[model samples]
Target: VFALVFAVSCENSNVKEEPKKEEFRPLIVRKDGQYIEYYPGHKQIKMKGREDADGNRAGIWKLFSQDGVELSITVYTKGKKDGHIVVRYPNGMPNYVGEYVMDERVGEWKFYAETGELLETIVYDEPTKENK
Candidate 1:
């Protein structure tokens, strides 16, 4: 009887356990005529912006860090980057500011130090058709 009980316990110990499933929730929603997306578990907002009728990113979009801090602001037209873009450090200081034309960087781009001082500026020339 002791041998039989020992064998049963060993068999049970060898049994495989199923993996746990991760929880996921929908992120996108429509609020006040705008479409917004939230982070998993609804802990914080991930992005808020407008989407075209075809569900493409349009107008201005703001993305946030996992901690709910604004990370970047970008303007999109038909899912393509256009207009001005600003990216910030995790500490909420501006890291860079630049403009885009049809997904191509244009004009002058400004970089900032962590102290919010201007670091450097770069000028981007228009791309030629051959190089584009």
Candidate 2:
């Protein structure tokens, strides 16, 4: 009964709201070549550490091709790639997905073709005498 009443009240509420949009605050560069490529057709692209008001890069950053196909999706923790980074083919199909440690491949990395077929798997392991 309370739920029904609350639902009706919510439907009649006159609250104007805006959908949350991803924010892209440009980083100020003191040196040359320090800007993230946030759009497609961006040649000679370079990226610098993005920061928040408190100076943190805890946001989503993407790269694209000239045809507007998403090339990569990388998330940063304190300005380093500390999460899943996805790379796609120019045709927009997934090319690779894996874990990264400070932008270095650290775990299982899977590669796929433009048609979504598995292409390969890469595992990082130190060379052992027996395996060598």
| Cα RMSD (angstroms) for every candidate in the order listed | 7.2, 15.2
Worst-scoring 10-residue span by lDDT in model 2: 26-35
Question: Highest TM-score, which number?
Answer: 1
Model 1 lDDT per residue over 2-106, tens place: 999999999999999999897766788885548878887888999899988877778999999999889999999988888899999988999999998878888
Show the colliding residue pairs in model 1: none
Q: For candidate 1, give the lDDT of residue 5.
A: 100
TM-score of each: 0.69, 0.50
lDDT of 2 by residue, 33-71 (tens): 234543333343434335555555655667666566678
Worst 10 residues of 1 by lDDT: 123-132
What is the alpha-carbon lDDT for the whole of candidate 2?
A: 0.66
Error of 1 at 58 (Å): 0.6
